[model samples]
Target chain A: EAGVTQSPTHLIKTRGQQATLRCSPISGHTSVYWYQQALGLGLQFLLWYDEGEERNRGNFPPRFSGRQFPNYSSELNVNALELEDSALYLCASNDLGDYGYTFGSGTRLTVV
Target chain B: AQSVTQPDIHITVSEGASLELRCNYSYGATPYLFWYVQSPGQGLQLLLKYFSGDTLVQGIKGFEAEFKRSQSSFNLRKPSVHWSDAAEYFCAVGARSRGYQKVTFGIGTKLQVIP
Candidate 1:
């Protein structure tokens, strides 16, 4: 079985621009999670999608949002990106209510 | 509110030396604890987790962690370190409350191995 997969391995966007990152969950997985690993900020949870529904989100601003498709794939969109938005955005998948999550390689977003 | 803290920002250990990374968490109920390793420019990998039952849990790559509820700590340990062990290690805590699984990760500790 394939693990979680993410598209656009790297991205470079200017400030005030918008960015969209994508993720596909593993086979038979129904939950997708998004996390941001910023420099010196560690890994922060961005959003959680389960069964095609937004379940939970972190303390991030409203400009940071995402959604999950019926196939359990997810897309994270950042509007009005700032230089601090430069970070590795990771996607993880797991069975609903499962304790463990398998993560993807992540998309490195660089906001210039 | 749940939070995890890894007091050590970075640690350097000689090859073949013992290693221990400390992790502390604050939660009211029994928290699900985990340890993850991330290589340079790579995603995080699960090392091990502590849900219940055994206080000591063994993980892949000859790593292990002991959960001390009284001390509110779950520290990762290895008998001998290898150069390959040099990476960023993260400690995470998850709550199984309200039928939701929300995990909180620590600030992470970067390990440097000296050969």
Candidate 2:
């Protein structure tokens, strides 16, 4: 079966602009997670969605928000993007209550 | 909350040599431990995990990890290294929150294999 899928492997946006990244979880998965991997900074959790509900989020600001679709697909939105937001954004999926997640290749967002 | 620490930022080992990556975790209770490997421009792949039962767990690609409860550590080990094994390794700790798994990752350790 195909793993978690992400669209537009690379994206470029101007500072203060908005960016939207999409993800399709593996079939039968119910939970979607978003993470930001910045240079020098490790993976930082952005958001978690389960059953189309926002379950939890990390220490990120309100500008970083996302929603999960009915079909378990997810969209991550970064508003008012800044140069520091240039990093690899990854999406992962897993079954509810599962211990591990399957991650996508990620979208590299460059804010100039 | 839970956290993970991979003390080593990078390591180099020759092919055919044994390899070990250190990992430490802090949690109130027993946690779900994991080892993930990511190649350049690729997503993370599960190398192994330890939830319960035997402390020693075997995973794909000749990888294995031992969970030490006393030390609160789960270290990844490979008997023989391969050139393809060169990548960044992340150690994570998972805890149950609101019936879902919440995971935290370490800074990651970059592995370099030499011939």
The CA lDDT at B63 in model 1 is 100
Once superposed on the true structure, which residue ranges of model 1 sit more than 4 Å away at CA? none
Question: Once superposed on the true structure, which residue ranges of model 2 sit more than 4 Å away at CA?
Answer: none
- Please give the lDDT score at residue B91 for candidate 1: 97
Enumerate the chain B TM-scores of all models. 0.98, 0.98
lDDT of 2 by residue, B10-100 (tens): 9999999999999999999989999999999989999999999999999999999999999999999999999999999999999998677
Instruction: Give the worst 10-residue stretch by lDDT in candidate 1 chain B.
Output: B95-104
- Please give the TM-score of chain B in predicted model 1: 0.98
Which candidate leads the pack in lDDT? Answer: 2
RMSD to the hidden true structure, all candidates: 0.9, 0.8
After aligning candidate 2 to the native by TM-score, how far in Å is the CA of A30 from where it should be?
Answer: 1.1
| Candidate 2 vs. true structure, TM-score | 0.98
- Model 2: per-residue Cα lDDT over A1-112, one tens digit each: 9989999899999999999999999999999999999998999999999999999999999999999999999999999999999999999999985788899999999999
- The count of residue-pair clashes in candidate 2 stands at 0
